[model samples]
Target: MVTGKAIVLSVLVTLSVVVRTASQLPIPPRYDGFVYKNRISADSVLVEAFFDPLCPDSRDSWWPLKEALRYYKHNITFIVHPFALPYHNNAFIASRSLHVANKINTSYTFPLLERFFRYQQNFYNKPTLQTSPATITQQIIHFALEKTGNSSFEKFVLGFQDKSSDMTTRISFKYGCSRAVTGTPYFFVNGIPLNIEETLDFAKWKSIIDPLLAEQAQAYT
Candidate 1:
């Protein structure tokens, strides 16, 4: 999240108009074993969020994000783009884990991701405590098993370890680099960057988002 006076500056930059609609944009490249959500057809505002699982700031933004989601709900569709910052080794694993969950089904992915975010603060405080990828995978598996009550958790966990997940991780890196996104939690609303300073005072951000969502709502009517 952009903060302090920088928030204003960032929001100003974000509001810079990029003259392209969702239909004009190319289909994002699909990496092997990866599932991409075609958000343009969803009848909601498209929000693409670039995040790192281990980043404290990313975790910090969760409450506000949830509030925003609730405030918009069906009026917005959020697509999470994984940006695994390498310094936090576990972050990449978390991203790949989401890809693995996505492979099985879209419904499972969001719940599991919410679970992961719930534990993010604990995970961040004890980076060394994560042990191995297998350990992390098991933790996620247990969470899924309990939440979904699925009997196939063991098979799913094993599948989650596949090397093919690397492709989506690479795609994330490339997308970030191309967009000049050097930080975690970068966001785009309707493919337009927000201009924090110019367009997003704390009060203004919600005002801007609400009207765009209203426009999307009207488009459907």
Candidate 2:
């Protein structure tokens, strides 16, 4: 009986140590900031998202919101920010790559975003996988080639890295840190927090978005 008790204690100690170590690791950056897209109006009810490409919840939240965009194009402006947490091995590189893509071809953003989510494990850090920035860039470039059928992906990728990559990363990280935003798929519609896990309802979206757009429209009129 005493020997069994000792074994149990040892197991508990091991778990405790593991838990502590995991806890000490940096949490992935919280989704934060305002990213406006295809501005149709001066005050198009702005929607901002803090997202992680590898996060399942981010993937879940993305489609519905993206679908809603088509219907609300003239009435709303949507912006994205990358609040990638440091603990996530490839998140920073992924986020930086996103900004690069944005500058090269704005059209590439959503398609690439969807691809990463659909193939999350493709980018997840593995013990044996090369996780350097160059490798990550190649992965993105390959995806772009397949998706866009653009042979110029090489030029676009390099241009993004050279011009706006670092700036975009800095802005995303700073915005997230300042807002204390910490989650995979957090959003604000007209500066109001969106409960993505709960409603995410298209009709529910209209309820909030319509009013903001109307208010802005009235102000302009």
Candidate 3:
């Protein structure tokens, strides 16, 4: 026979355990954006990276990120979200091009991104005058034409130059904003924000990510 106070205390303790367990559970991957599904395990941790092609910080982080992805390719699923920063003159066009290219051919996504980052500085005009959006779009179209030699892709790019493309770009930007992303090269692991500093260090990233994978493995076992 327990007193009412003891019964209430027991209920609270049980609820706390339930809450903690739920908080530790892995979050399902988002529907939007590219998802590199893991071949090893469906329970692999999810990594969401928000990047701006024109951002120097994002460019700096790209190599380390690729290394980590290559090393942990079996243990994690990666997704990329383009967040165009307002300060860059051609950031919007760069991001929109990537999005549209992905739609046209998923294979084109990474090569185009690499090209943008490789020649990022060339895309910007003098500090006194910004490049026009139309010019930037044409540059991207030219890149696609040269890479694929697909006249259909050129037609698609020209046709996509409207409010719809603007809306799509805004939607992608807002998705990052809603997640409290204030800058490029931001990352989330298992639905939690990962420190940018840690992201730069491959060893630190492995330490942080390995445990998550192990935990997921234990859950399956």
Please provide TM-scores, in order, for all candidate models, with all chains considered together.
Answer: 0.67, 0.70, 0.76
Candidate 1 Cα misplacement greater than 4 A, ranges? 1-43, 125-130, 195-205, 213-221
Q: How would you encode candidate 2's per-residue C-alpha lDDT over 46-142 as one tens digit per residue?
A: 7888888777778777777877887887667788777777766777776776776666667777676778789877777674166676777677677
Instruction: Sort all candidates by lDDT, best to worst.
Output: 3, 2, 1
**Best model per TM-score:** 3
For candidate 3, the 10 contiguous residues with the lowest summed lDDT are 23-32
Model 3 lDDT at residue 122: 73
Tens-digit per-residue lDDT, 1-221, candidate 3:
89999999999999999988874523324445555532435667778888998888888787877788889876778888889998877788888887777667677777778788887887765631665667667777787555555754755565466565566677778788878999989999889998655337677678878888788778879
Task: State which candidate, 1 or 2, has the greater TM-score.
Answer: 2
Position 135, candidate 1: lDDT: 79
The model with the greater TM-score, 1 or 3, is: 3
Model 3 C-alpha lDDT versus the unseen true structure: 0.75
List runs of model 2 lying over 4 Å from the truth.
1-37, 126-133, 160-164, 195-199, 213-221
Please, what are the lDDT tens digits per residue for candidate 1 over residues 48-109?
76777667666666557667766766666777777888777677777776776776676666
